[model samples]
Target: MKKIFLVAIAVFTLIACDKKEVDADANIHITGDVKGLSQGKLYLQKIQDSALVILDSIIVNGDSKFESHIKLDSPEMLYLFLDRGQTNSIDNSLPFFAEPGNIKIETTLKHFFADAKISGSKNHDLWKKFDSINSKFRDQNLALMEKRLKNELKPNATTTDSIEKAYKSLLTRKYRYTAHFAATNGNKEIAPYLALSEIADINTTYLDTIQKSLTPEVAKSKYGKMLNEHIKERKTLEVQK
Candidate 1:
């Protein structure tokens, strides 16, 4: 009887341990390695209530390997800030999307932001997709501006009309693309984020449509709340006009 009781207790202990491990994994876990950083500080930052806040901070010792865990209500953008106790602002912060799971970051202390490798978040991958599309629009705008500057063109009847037409065309294409993107990704958090950031001024009705299409959980997120507020303010402005 005593032997059987001991065995049962041991099995229960193992089960409890496994449950704890699973719970830990469900919380936010970040592990980092920074070469050439024997001692310093690393901070996790996020935007909250219209202000930038540090979510967590850790001290770096010998091997420059550090770990931190935090609770997340939802997936969102985060910044890794490295404070080397120097005046240089360059290469001090890196922005990445974070979700509740294990994340890893590896980089050198010198080029902290420039060469960091981050992985292990689904939301981060989605943000990359959105970023890739947004970058193309920026490249197109850059090409347009460069052509105008290089030509040393004067703003007159002959040149200004064509330039203005080109600008309008670019805006139209961007607005249409933003609408399509939001429609397709309505269930994802990135939909409202893009609507607010990429095409906030496109049209209030379209923004309203995107907001209405968001999943209930995403619609209640920080970015979603901001998007809703923006649409409301736009409507108020139109009424005043």
Candidate 2:
């Protein structure tokens, strides 16, 4: 009878251990390797009330691989900050969309953000797609500004005015593209995030359209709440004008 009781206790302990692990898995688990990095500090951070907050951190002593875990109420944009213990600070932070799951990031110390390979978050994938196209718009804008500067040296009013008009047109197109992208992806958290981050200064009509199209769940997210508040403030300021 004592042997049988011992066997039952062992089964119970195993069940309890398994249950505990399953519960832990429900939280955000971030694991990654920073190549060419022998020692540094990695911080998992998020923006709260317009301020950056660290959720978790790990010290990398000898191993390049690091892991961090935190609980998130909803899917939001998160940043990974690397402190390389150097005086010259550049390319030290990497941004990735984080949700309640396992996310992996792999990158080298040389090109932190540019060389990052992130996976396990659908929201991050959508952001990547949006950024790819947005980069082209930015490049075109830069080229137009450069041409305008060159024309300024000759002091041609007509050429300067023409370039200014083209630049304004390009800016409007970029804003419109951002609005449409947010409106169409209302079901995801990225929609409100783009609205608040990329096109907050856009026309009130476009902002209202994006806000209304957001899903109920996303509309209550951190970015969605901020977007709503921003629109209200903008309208209030316009009314006073």
Candidate 3:
């Protein structure tokens, strides 16, 4: 009876340890982000010698956030792609000489690929970094829009001026974040400058929601036109050359 009892306890201990390992593997968190995008998608590919071995993709919610878990038996190059426009960015193939457990990569297009590495525990820390970067990007964009508006606007005009200010404000916020996000995170394939391709859509969505409060003429001011044209040209360059 004593011998049987000892065996039962040993078996239980092994079972418990096995369960813990499985739980840890399932919880290995992977995360990423893009700027100025309401939402997008990201893909992770396991590569060997510059060739893909396996591919895993996840949707970056409408808020431009994402999370996942990667199971690694060995170190491989992690390939990231933006779902919006077939954009591909790479964080130099990671050589996980150290056993892989949890890995987190958080960054915007502007500098995402430029600097992404194992951040922390790969769970909460990953989410926190993505959120932190987004918040910083928003704050910076607001400041930029404010400065640009003050420089360009007429102080005395009421309705037309207010509408124009609002339009520029919204566009500036979107463009600054999106453009920088892409630029920072992008690779040779999908550089951040390409974000300009979606500028019109972003502007249309914002203006349509507020159209009842502002006239078309005010939204199409010389400054607005100039801004859009400039962004479009940049987008063209990003894609073409």
Per-candidate TM-score against the hidden true structure: 0.76, 0.85, 0.32
- On lDDT, the stronger of 2 and 3 is 2
For residues 130-224, could you state the per-residue lDDT of candidate 2 as single tens digits? 99999999999899989987997888988888898999899899999999999999999999999988988988999999999999999998888
C-alpha RMSD between model 3 and the true structure: 17.9
Cα lDDT, all candidates: 0.81, 0.89, 0.48
Model 2 pairs whose backbones collide? none
Q: Rank all candidate structures by their lDDT, best first, as comma-separated numbers.
A: 2, 1, 3
| Candidate 1 residue-wise lDDT, 138-226, digit = tens | 88889878767755654456565676688789889878888887867777777887887688898887998899889988888877888
Clash count per candidate: 0, 0, 18
Off by over 4 Å in 1: 1-26, 87-89, 148-160
Worst 10 residues of 2 by lDDT: 17-26
Give the higher-lDDT candidate: 1 or 2: 2
